[model samples]
Target: MRGIDLFLTLVVMLSLGAVLWPFLFYPLILRMLTTRPEQPGQGQPPSASLLFCAYNEAVAMPEKLANLAMLKRRHPQLQILAFDDGSSDDTAALIAAQGDLVTLVQGPGRSGKAHGMKRLAVRARGDVLIFTDANVLLDAEAIDNLLARYADPQVGGVLGSLHYLGEGKSATASVGSLYWRIEERLKDEESRTGNVLGADGSIFSIRRALYPDFPDSVLDDLTVSMAVIFAGKRLVKAKDVIARERLVAARGDEYRRKVRIAARAWHTHGHLRPQLRRMSAIDRFKYASRKIVRWFGGLFILTGVMAAFALALRIAPLLAMVGVTLALILLALGLRSKGGPVAAVVDILIAYAATLQGVFKAMSGRTVTVWNPAKSR
Candidate 1:
């Protein structure tokens, strides 16, 4: 009942609220604000360019090239562009062997995906540019679905739904898959209410003219997609326009991937600060809720738990120790990386820690521009 205790309790509450706001309340708020379902307009398919940047993706090249071949056959005019990021593997050769199927651009060195994408974008002559990963496979109708959205002049971009192939394979995969599902739901809501904030590289498309030049350190998908909103156009998600990729099942690989992604995301936030400020109030709310707040999740959870433990200690030292012991036990169980509730919680905590590491790296002006495809994925 002391003022200091009350203040500590209040801090704990606020921290918890900030941490959970994005994951829990944000969706509910979106549901309240969401308008009628978004529907694509009717029209002939747009002239489209499929662009992807690859780094040492030889393992997936054969299947990927075949997929692209199928797409090219489906839409004969679809311009397919590929950038080889100075790979030591046969990636360039494989892409080159396809000859005209893919307009292959070889980078001088490891310039990175963003740099390669910029190069591809410049050469792309299509009306709409579709960006995706080398390993991600799109549904047969994904291109048609994506192109149909641009029938509405107000539609500047469309994000495709991504499904993970290995959800229950491991604790890490399960949590990652579940987290992705929640993200998709949020994107759906964001699309219905307004712009979907940003897009992922797995599958998304934008008007070719709206492609904005950005630094290599920033996340290209997010930067390019958000520009559509900045251009006063809707960036909606089409559930039928789907892409599929395997989840990184190994704990270490997934952790490193999240860390790399988070770090670049934070760096991108810093770069886009001015433009982000110019967004509509509602979009600003969505960005802050869905992105800014979630990035600090690790810090919030740490702060809240420490404050709660301190308050509990002030009340009863034995009870505080008991609670701490129980938490540590659960964390140890999670560290084993087996599938279960305890392991899932541990996996989430580890993810938060990785993300926090990434955010801190961005704060320290360190970022990951170049990347190798996750092997376990």
Candidate 2:
């Protein structure tokens, strides 16, 4: 029993390390070894479509439309399309008000983002499809920068960086903002080496010809990125292209978003596993090591907790107590720290807690039906 406890603890710790090291450390190593490639010429720009899916987003419609108009001015050939997903608000009317400047799609009811995207895709006339969220403000050069990456035939998709606006309004929002920046840096490094695991929904561009239709329940951006990767095309990140948005200010907003994301990720795992066997050994290893383990981190945490409890009763009570004490101290420090090293530590703890919650919910056979939309940050 003692041997079993020790072994389980070791396994849990190693699994945690394997899951986080690639995303947090390998990127830094890649940056040291890589140099940015020269920018490709903007030579005849490809026809592109700007796609936005709005659900009760009337409050943001005016600014979103103005931003699209600005983008059209820069890229004269760009076409804009907006979808209203059974919004209870004035979103449909707002899109209709834009007239020819934007093509409007209305749905009988809310079918979620994946359905809206597919509907827009069917109507898209551009060779390149760029998807942006209603809440994001795209920089004037965002589309130009995104399309420029297609100059590399090896690159099939490009993901843009998201800058969190209004971050300083609250501590939670500030922490979220910092977390996003760290994520972007890690993704940029992953792209420099080869392929990014996935892209944010706010700003990612893909070839319309390569787009795959996915179930509405799955996370649309992740499904799109994985589909492209499984097709043997590279999905790269465009750090120069920026989309800015405010952090959702509410405390529970992040928690709700994480839960839905965890559920979708769990679902996507099975869908993506069959394709993994066909990928290069490096990619296969990277995906399993970095992504698969993290998805199961909550299980490991529970295992670790169980092992600690068993070991305390059977053998080293003092050591077990010390370990628990240390964990509490770390968590407390994390909660009190501003958005820096301490806050980052807190983010990790919060992430771990959320992961644990997801695992518990899954184990209890609880169907996660309540889709709490993320607060705009």
Candidate 3:
């Protein structure tokens, strides 16, 4: 019994520590690291290719391109390319309607985002490649801001700050939005330290030469940014170049999106490990702490809860009660948008089950190549 008690306590401590490390220790350590100012914007603005990947995004593409066109007018040297990844909808027709103003790559059929991006990359003929999603509205000066950072010469990529707009007044939207706020801040800190782990797919720019036509199974932004890091180049965060998109309002949709992303993350990591191993000790540590730990952080929380319960059974009932209470509070906060306590609890449980399913799929070597665009907010 004594042995069991000690073991359970240690397990609980370690598990909970994993959960708290990113929220507490990770940020604290980064804050302590002196903030490095970005290299000043230099030379002429690099000729840029504004690239877009679309699949069944007809409803949003027209508006998105209008914004891009405006951007093109501002920067006469900018080239625009749109790849329609075999959308069944009128996506191809819409791109065609843009005339010669935009180059359209309508592939054979349903190849997926990675393939679409690959096609776009081959067609892109610019010093810089600006990748934007079909739903994002880019600011007119986004390209200028991103290009300025490239003056440092060391920076291989620039990740733009993307904010969520129109997250309804729902409690769930607020929670999701707040979570992004925390995530973005952490990313900024990572950038300041000169070791950002990934870029946002919504809007980011990379030196054309550094771009890798990564495998279709890999997450584009992560692999691209990490590829830059692997080559001994810097990936900086450009908060001034902003883009806005609607938050995922439906809980089910949000859960599915997270699970799909989590599975892809697991797949991508296998390909990343070899590159990561060759990195400097500090770079390796930062990647593990920032990416690896966060990827499996949910598991840590799960383990902590189980260990706490086991400890409570053997040693203190209050331990289990406290764990349950905290969990209930979290569930309550998560459910605030879903309506009552019962619905929120149900959604939380569903989310957990979905997460477990995603992990299992990942472990089984399954990958989600096809994707459904989540319903707009």
Candidate 4:
């Protein structure tokens, strides 16, 4: 009975820690509350490169290029590079039609986004490299807002705010959008105080000198941003600089994305050990709280529930009943096709499960480099 009690206590503590780790951003929040808005930079604009990777985005490519063209008008010094990762669609032709307006790189087949980015970097001439996706729409002032932080010599990267464009009033979309809001708020605070663990892949910029030639297995956003932090440079936020992308509408698509992200995160964990040790005390804490704990948290949740059930059977039925009831509620929502508060709970559970699978795959020497864009958007 004593051993049982101890096991239950350990399980509960682990579960609670997993749940509460996100609140670690609160201190950074307090710092932001005391700070004032920064003035815009007055220095001449540095040579900047806008880089993007295209898969099969023929329909969206023209509009995206138009936006970049307008941005180019505003900042003539900006250079643009586009790479088509073996797209079977008109993506290549559209890029070819751009002529001298854009520099097109021959992507060596569908070698995945990380490899494509590495290839593009070799040809980038700008002191600052802005990486983004083809699907996201960037505001005209986004570049200006991002470059503003370069005025500070220590700032190595700037992450732009990502806002999700809802397809309709679906509950699933709401849940995903709400999650992004919470994530962005945490990132905002982290950027205000120190460094963001990673940047929004839809829109982020870093100094060309700080670029890490990450292997194809790593997530570009997390790898590059963390590399900046590990290099003893700060990453700041430009919330006014916004990029928009449509939210994935289906729960299954969302699940797959979480799985892919988790798998890459697990890969990053092992690959970055040396750099992790080089991190400052505060940055180390941030990485552990933001990345490590969350990756393996699903196991804690599962263990906590099993232990709670056993304890309830022996001595605490009421607490066990409450846990069981909540679990059922989440389970039912997860099985459903619709979105709501229950669906949100279901999404969280799915994410936790994906994290477990991702970690397991990573531990077993499995690596996932190629990606299939979810069709649910």
Q: Write the per-residue lDDT of candidate 1 for residues 262-327, one digit (tens) a residue.
A: 999999999999999999999999999998898999999999999999999999999999999999
Q: Which ten residues in a row have the lowest lDDT in candidate 2?
A: 364-373
User: Per-residue error at 120 for model 3, in Å?
Assistant: 0.6
Which ranges of candidate 2 are over 4 A from the true structure?
1-12, 28-43, 305-347, 356-372, 375-377
**What does candidate 4's lDDT look like per residue over 1-377, in tens digits?**
88988888787777876766665544443454444344454677677898988888887888888888889899888889988889988988998899667888867688888888888888999999999998888999999878878887788888999999873545667777877887888777777666777775899999999999778888887888777887778888888989988888887787778878888778877888898898877677767776687787788788776776887767877877887888787787566747656766777777788778888888888867767666766
Alpha carbon lDDT of each predicted model: 0.92, 0.75, 0.79, 0.80
RMSD, one per candidate, in order:
1.4, 3.7, 2.9, 2.8
For model 2, residues 1-377, the per-residue Cα lDDT tens digits are: 65776786686676556555656655555667555453465456678998988888878878888988898888878889888888887878988988878999987786777788889999999988999998899998888888888887667788999998888765567767766887788777767767778777889988888898666666678888777788878888988899988787555676667666676666656556677678776566557645666667666666766755665655777887887888789778767765556656566556666765764565454424224345454
Q: How are the candidates ranked when ordered by TM-score, highest leading?
A: 1, 3, 4, 2
Where is model 1 poorest over a 10-residue stretch in terms of lDDT? Answer: 34-43
- Count of clashes, each model: 0, 4, 0, 0
Candidate 2 residue 48 C-alpha distance from true site, Å: 0.2
Off by over 4 Å in 4: 6-10, 24-42, 167-169, 316-330
Measured against the true structure, the TM-scores of the candidates, in listed sequence, are 0.97, 0.84, 0.90, 0.90
lDDT of 2: 0.75
Q: Candidate 4 has what TM-score? A: 0.90
